[model samples]
Target: MFAMSNPERPVRLGFVGVGSRGTSMLQTALMLEGVEITAISDIVPERVERAQQLVMESGQPKPKGFTGEEDYKKIADLTNVDAVFTATPWSLHTPVMVATMKAGKYGGTEMPACDGYEEAWELVETAEQTGMHCMLLENYAYMRNVMMVLNMVRHGLFGELTHCETGYQHDVRYATIGDQGELLWRAHERYLHHTGNRYPTHAIGPVSQWIDINRGNKFEYLVSMSSRSLGLNHYVAKNYGADHPNAKRQYKAGDVNCTLIQTANGITVTLYYDSLSPRPVDFIYRIQGTKGIYSGTLDKIYLEDTSPVPHQWEDIEKYVEEYDHPLWKKYGDIAVQTGHGGSDYLCMRDFVEAIRHQAAFPIDVYDAATWSIITKLTEESVLNKSKPVDFPDFTRSKWRERKPLPIVNS
Candidate 1:
């Protein structure tokens, strides 16, 4: 309900990192109705040039592109740039996001916002202290099917969800090794270097939205376990053994990782993440309630109500059209066509609106901190052989003092 008149000019936007994901976001921003790319920073000179080329191709005023990591701060602090989208490496996200927020600019970062729990806390604290919007851009939350599921859950169609399972299982070994060279940044062997649910945000974020976590309930604790590394490490050893000195040094390619979470309301959510597998992208989201059960994998749902025949999964489009969530009812259509089924657009729109309207972001620092902690704790659990680990009480009871965030358009 916090609509605002279109700005006299587009909101000045900046980007750090013009890699594959960064380039896609840059293009999407250019296509948005009221956004202007004022500046961009990238470590690779070629990437900077490519971003400039994209600006010219899109018929927008060419943004000033800065090269090298040091220059990112300069671009982020630019007076013309109102917000920044950070698609940098996992390790670099903390610094870039923190600097952007400290410079009094809004920021959106890719998933696994930081590499560790402490970094996550720092990012959250900085955003809260500076009163800047910091959104963890987990695009999966915006997928059409996921949004439809969320809408149903919100409407009580699922009827007191007793249990839920979700996961992001995709094979990115080629992209991780081939494109990133032998030193895979996010691969288990290179950067993450630990066994827990390294990337739980994508799966957990949507589930959290459906359940209204951090508002009505919060995660209590979690336990996690992982399979031993295989497949990709062999591929890496054979392909890049000479190029990477550590290629044959027992690569710890992450296998499947699973986490069982307990919510404060006693609801349970099981999260799974796997990247080394050689399977098609599968985000299995399943929920069971007192009245019905919903399964994203089968694209089917079952209900106990006999008054009306349960809706068929094929009727998802109809349901979405007729019974979308209040927030999605307003922006769902536009969101579906955008990246990650329209989540990227909604996230970007919210970031910009928060800046323009001086409103609190829907996903605040605490939410980010909690989600990040889940991932960090999952890893800890894996290291401890799936031992139950207590979730840190980040709110320290402050959440009891706050109400559910209103669905404000701005």
Candidate 2:
């Protein structure tokens, strides 16, 4: 059982990072029935104050606020809290979470829980030794459509899933530069790493569940390739002037990176990271099974059974009633009220419930460590000119003996 033993009262929560994404999660925390924001922390006092205002407006008493350097420690040390929620930048996710686990609380973090393997191992080891839950807040895994597809896969609609493809494709030149045309930390990161799928889990997590990865199957090896970097510099030159120092900075990260991961069961997953391209956002998650296939972009699925019309495409919307995930069936309307098409709401709902009842998190530490550290493996493959890189079985052989976890109550 978790530190939180009482289910009747609200689950006391400590939140770190009240920026755009953090504040969004805070808003959801406000809506969930059994959650109470008790502490808030961020480097920006204004952000913390704003989040505190939201909590107060929700009719709860004012939450304790902490800001500036090392303020997160105050949240982790708070003995009254049942869980710690963090949406900090990539760098702080590990530090805040590691601290929360040490302080003996359930902790949930933004995607890519750790930037590298060593830090990821720390998360696994800590959770294993302490019996604390470390759930990665991978909202994509909870998307209604994705959940439907997962349910279908389990029901044998997509029999013996063989391959899956997913990616995070977006144009974000503006976020990387200041108004005066100075390179930000996000932009500088492109100049720092040679190449990798900087964002992997959003695409991988949903498909991992469908394919039984980190359970009966395991990611074996990966090969990665990147198109040369040009999109960012060109954007800088066009907007900030060709003579701008930002335009002259040599970006190490490629504009487009494609990574192929082969699993121990011979299931392959293709992942891409193209955050700087000139395109609208696209998840482009596609799955192929022995019986049929799914195309997320088109919102359609096809099957070997052609009774109505063999080999014909079927709009997934029509089958929603038949295969809607039980989680979605129960919480679909409430989920849409939160961010990311209601995925955020269900994620938080499940998290709060887990904390209150001391249940195992739906997305446990093994899933968190493997999905997050995949970034590092892809980098090795790309840096080696597309040589294959082995994915470490953070669960060792335990993944083989483990069974698939249910998305909804069985």
Q: Which candidate is the best by TM-score?
A: 2
Regions more than 4 Å wrong, model 2: none
How much is the lDDT of residue 359 in candidate 2? 81
**Residue 374 error, candidate 2, Å:** 1.4
User: Candidate 1: where are CA atoms >4 Å away?
Assistant: 1-8, 179-181, 188-192, 237-247, 306-318, 325-337, 405-410
How close to the true structure is residue 20 of candidate 1, measured as C-alpha lDDT?
A: 87
Cα lDDT tens digits for candidate 1, 1-410:
11223455577878898898999888777766777788888989899889988988887888998987677689777888877788887777778888888888877787678766689778878876887778777777666577677667766787988898999787777866754345556664232456677677888887887776778788888988888777566657667664564454454425788889999887899898887777888788888788887778886677677324656443344465655556577777766666776777777677766666656677766777777777678777877778899887666667656675443345
Clashing pairs in 2: 306-310, 335-342
The TM-score of candidate 2 is 0.97
- Provide the clash count, candidate 1: 2
Give a tens-digit lDDT track for model 2, residues 1-410: 35677679889999998888889999998888867899999888898899989998999989999986787887888877888989877877878888888888999999888888888899888888878888999999999889999888878887888888898887778888888888876775544455688778888899889888888998889899988898878888999899998787788889899989899988888898988878988888899888898888778888887425687778787789989999999888878999999999888888888888888888888899899888898888888889998888889799899889785742
Candidate 2 colliding pairs, count: 2
